[model samples]
Target: MLAVLASVFVISMSGALMPGPMFATVLAKSYKSPWAGAQVSLGHAVVEVPLILLIYFGAATILENDITHLILGIVGGGMIIWMGLGMLRARKAYAGGTKDTPYNAFTAGIILSAGNPFFIIWWATVGALLVLKIADYGLGGLTALVLTHWAVDLIWLSIVSGLVYKTHRLWAPALHEAVFVACGLLLMGFGGWFVVSGVLAIG
Candidate 1:
């Protein structure tokens, strides 16, 4: 059980550290509110919790189906591409220092996460495997795995948000815009990869 928890923490943190849609969203929102990352993580948990439960209840088979993966890949990839374009357009607004429309950070988190095919795929594979291992120790192990995974997300995202908030003034506008553009590009790249992978899988 101890090993399971430790492994979960390490793996979860590794995923969290990667630059994904959620990470990009956190960086964009962090400039406005230090709590943005936590809010986003909470929203992410909203989707994750249910999915985890589903996996625990033996819904892994559905996730593993090639057809299901193809559908998720197409839909999720399209959504991610749309988000990336939105972020690019928002770069001007960000540079102009215009206040963004009132929105719920938590909800944004959930949407970004739900739209990410990689996130779903990870849970279907790596996450499912972890769950199976933890299942050996019964419910207690499962509980530990889930909690540890979420805790890592919360801590890491909070730190990132706080850091961005604190350092907002230090970065030049051009530098900030550049960073945003880079994040947007990374997202688009991932989105394209997902689409291609899905197509290949279907073929």
Candidate 2:
């Protein structure tokens, strides 16, 4: 059980560390207001907790349904592309200023995290894997997996917020914009890939 739990923790942490629109948003907000970025990160994880539980508990049956995976894949992919586009648009508006409010970051984090489609697919797949192995470890594994995943998220957000707080003055607007655009492109590329893969799987 301990080994299984440890393995899941590592997997969860690796997945959380993968850069995405969520990470970019956290970093951007951190540059403007570190506290706000932290808040946003917390809110994002808060939303994810229930989702992970749902997926873990339900994926066993959920994955068996073609319709479920199809809807999830399409929705998730579309959402990533949309968020990438949004970031691109936001580049100019937020580049030079700290005027963006914490509430804005909080709200955006919640909405984007909640609406993200790729997360849905990934969790659904991973959740199924957990469910299969869950019986081998019982409640202890479950608890550890959940805790470790959230901890990773908190740590990542803190790092972003701390770095921005410490170095915001030195960070140039152009560099920020460039980062945003690059992240946006990466998101769009992944989204497109998901859509294509999902379609191929369905066909």
Candidate 3:
């Protein structure tokens, strides 16, 4: 059981630590609030709760559909690109540290989690495996599985946002602009990739 839980943690962290739309969203928002990560984590949970239930109900088959991936790729890709543009436009807007971002951390979390096709796909494949492995132990195991998986997200996001918050606390305008630009570009790149892949797949 310990081994199962431990493996889940490790696998969860591997995904959480990867640079993706969600990570970019967190980075884009951390400029204004150090607690963005926690807020985002809550938002992530909002989506995840339903996802966990879906896994229990064997929803992976639906998520694995090629048409499903293509549709999500297009729709989600557009949203991510829009988000990246927002970031780029707001790159310097947060310098004063008083205004709120267009999308709050929580909303960004929800949107990114929902919009990122890879996220859904991961849940379908890797997430399903983790849940099934632990679900065999019954309710307690299932509970641990959810908590452990989310815990990894929470811890990693908090640390990242916290560090960014602290760094920006010094009000390094140059660093702020540079990082936001980089993050914005990164998101745009990922968005483009998703769209292109989807298009190619469809063709």
Candidate 4:
């Protein structure tokens, strides 16, 4: 069990460090809320908890189907692209400064996460395997997996967002826009890859 927990933490932390849609959102939203990382992680949990449950109950087949992946890649990828474009459009608004929108980062977490093909794919495969393996140890192992995953995500995301937030005061208007643009483009790049891969798979 200790080995499982440690392995899970290492794996989750490695993945959390990757520059995914969530990471990009963390960078952008950190300016709005210093606690954006925790908020986003909570939002992500909203999707992840249910997903883990579904997988636990034997829904992995449906989740792993090629057709499901195709649809997820197309639809989720489009949502991510839309978010990237939205961020670009709203970049100028930050120049005037902004307040915490409360649910802003939270919803971004849920939506961006739900729309990420890689997130879905990970849960469908590696995550699903982990779920099954934990099942043998009963509910305790399963609980550990969920909490462990979330904890790793929370820690990593909080640190990243905190650093971004702390340095935000030094950003010039141009720098703010530049960061937003970079983050937005990063999201679009990920979306594009998912979309293209999905399309090719369909062919």
> Who is ahead in lDDT, 1 or 3?
3
lDDT at position 24, candidate 2? 69
Off by over 4 Å in 2: 40-47, 55-59, 98-103, 107-118, 131-141
* Model 1: lowest-lDDT 10 consecutive positions: 95-104
Question: Against the true structure, what is each candidate's TM-score?
Answer: 0.91, 0.75, 0.92, 0.92
Score candidate 1 by TM-score against the native: 0.91
Candidate 1, position 56, lDDT: 90
Each prediction's RMSD over C-alphas, in Å, is: 1.9, 3.3, 1.7, 2.0
- lDDT values for all models: 0.81, 0.67, 0.82, 0.83
Q: What total of clashing residue pairs does each candidate reach?
A: 0, 1, 0, 0
Clashing pairs in 1: none
Candidate with maximal lDDT: 4
**Comparison by TM-score, 2 against 4, better one:** 4
Worst 10 residues of 3 by lDDT: 92-101
Q: How big is the positional error of residue 185 in model 3, measured in Å on the Cα after superposition?
A: 0.9
